[model samples]
Target: MKKKELIMIGLMIFSLFFGAGNLIFPPIIGKEAGTNMPITMIFFAVTAIIFPVLGIIAVAKSNGLKNLAGRVDSVFAIVFTVATYLAIGPALAMPRAGTVPFEIAIAPYLPEGSSVKTALFIYTTIFFGVVYWLSLNPNKLLDRISKITSPVFLILIFMLFLGTFIKPMGNYAQPSEIYSKNLGLQGFLDGYLTLDALAALNYGLVVVFVIKSKNIIEEGKITKTVITTGIFAGMMLFIVYMMLAHVGASSASMFPHTKNGAEILANTVRYSYGDFGGILLASIFTIACLNIGVGLTTSLSQYFNLLIKKVPYKIWATIWVIWSYILANMGLNKIMEYSVPVLLAIYPASLVLIMLALLDKWIKGNTIIYKAAVYPTVAVSIISTLDKIGISVPLLTVLAKKLPLHNADLGWISVTVVSFIVSFCIVHFSEENK
Candidate 1:
């Protein structure tokens, strides 16, 4: 691909990853982290940017997520792949894409007597309608998102930043209770809420499809291009997070008691630009969510159509859009309440799988090594998620917190590393015995 094409593809990928949760999490961290924002953002970038970029690279190098996870076992490959698509697709992220714009940019401005539920239904119907139409023709996505929509989205965000610079809301206040301790860990955990890493696994193939559409067929060239595009996209995400965090921090005193980043963001723009701020924010979110909705709807339909040949791509697309529409009406907070625990559960396993794929040469495609590394990580992840959601597994939850990084909600890392080591030793020992 040419340099210009590479840049556009990077922008497109960035838009795909920057959806509902992406817009909301950063500012809340900035607001809560206050003086700790700098350190907090660095850790946030690890999961939000670095891991996501690595996921794309890993999937590209391995051809696809299913192929990468299949190295563990066929059953795991099927299960994980399906779970990931759903988690980032119709199950959570897709519904979020539909609802967030309405919540942050539209709902607040709704006429007092208007039914919020009815407004949401009308808005989402139109939202997903545009999404479905654009998704039907994935070939135009690069032009639609990167060339047209994403640039406009960036401009609106810059306007918010300009407003902040022109008239600062308030100074970054003291750290909140949650951000008072383990600020770095808190930031990292917050980044998980974006769910971009899972999107990375799914979006990598979408990028590949775009590249092949341009007739770039060489495997080596495709891998190199995809990795390059991922890096560029990661850099963009980092920059935007920095801007959003600053905006959040500045809004600290003005919107101190806000619940989530959505509230902070809406308040920031409104405070900065008066009545016009609502329009600006609404445009920004609608563009951002629309980009994501199209990318995801297209990608999910493509993947599922390939997986289940009986269901045509259009049917799958319609099914997801309808499902997302139904779930989106349940309201954003409720959707997030149910989705966060599931995201927490699967995110660790996704990270582990990405790391293992990147280290594939060392493991030499050993299924034993794959199982050893992934299974324990997944087990610990499930227990940790259960504990987080207030479900105490008998003996397991207590054992999980004892592991390193549990306080940071990263207890699975140690388990995964230990399992990898034991599996490595067993593989080598058995080979030597033979």
Candidate 2:
């Protein structure tokens, strides 16, 4: 491929990875981090930026979607592949795509006395209906809309940031309880919950499919192109995240303390550019989210078509649209709450699997060594999920409570350590047996 084309592909990949959560997360971190915003930004960027870039590189290096997860085991590969795709598709992404439009766009136009829930219900139904129709023919039109909307989203965010610098929103407030003690560490941990790294693995497959269709790269060159594109994409994410964090930090005094991230974002934009700015930000987010909905619906339909030969793409697309609309109508808060536990269960395992995929040559895929590495990874992931949902897994919770960092999020870190140690032992045992 020519240098110019590769550069364009890199930009496209970057935009694809930058979605709703990408826009919301950094600002929340900044607001909570208060005076220590810079340290928080750096920490947030590790998982939000660095890990996602690594995921994209891993996908590019692994050859294809199947190969990426196949390193662990065939059963694991299928489960991981399907679960990851679903997480990014209808299960989470689609409903989010629908909700953002309602919360950001439609809510602003309604009368002060109107019901937000009722408006959300009507808006999401229409939104997903359009999403379904457009997804019926997943062509260049979806690409065109995304290309147009992505830049608009960036521009609106830039305006918000620019507003922060031009006119201050009072001085920064005191740090929140979580941020007061271990600002950087908390910021880093929060970044993991954004789940963009998990999204990157899925988006990488789309990137590979697009590249192959264009004949820009052969099988041998796929890895190099993916890695290059991911690096370029990561750079873009870092810049955008920094800008948003700056906006959040600077405008800390404008918004009162709010438990929900969405409210904080809404208040931030309103403070920066007034009501007009808030409306504009909402419009951009809504449109960008709509494009995401189209992309996800199209992808899910194609996946189901492959899995069930008799089920047509159009039929599945319709089903996805209807289901997503129902979920979206349930409201963003509900969707987010339901999704957290599931994401907690899947993300750690997915991260471990992606890392294993990238190191496939050294590990030797699907051997006893690989299964051993995988077992501990799975064990740790289960513990992580249990902790995330506030569930006390009797044995693990007892063990965790006994540890030094037990009170904090450090229990998950301990699980991670045990996973690595167990993996090492497996590799050692396999070598000795050989």
What's the number of clashes in each of the models? 0, 0
TM-score of each: 0.95, 0.87
Global lDDT of each candidate: 0.88, 0.71
Where does candidate 2 clash, by residue pair? none
The residue-by-residue lDDT of candidate 2 on 114-211, one tens digit each, is 99888888778777877776677754532554456556766876777777767777776677898889887887887887787787777665677656
Model 2 misplacement above 4 A? 112-118, 133-142, 171-177, 256-260, 331-335, 387-394, 400-434
1-434 in candidate 1: lDDT tens per residue? Answer: 78999999999989998887788888888988998898999999998999889888888888888899999999999999998898878887888888889877999899899998899999999999999988888788888888999889889888988888898788998888778888877888888767788888998788888888889889999989888888899899999999999999989887778988888888888888999999999999999899889988988988898889999988998998888988888766777788778878888889988999889888888999999999998899999898878899999999998998898788998889989999999999999999
Error at 307, model 2, angstroms: 3.2
Root mean square deviation (Cα) for candidate 1: 1.8
Measured with C-alpha atoms, the lDDT of residue 212 in candidate 2 is 74
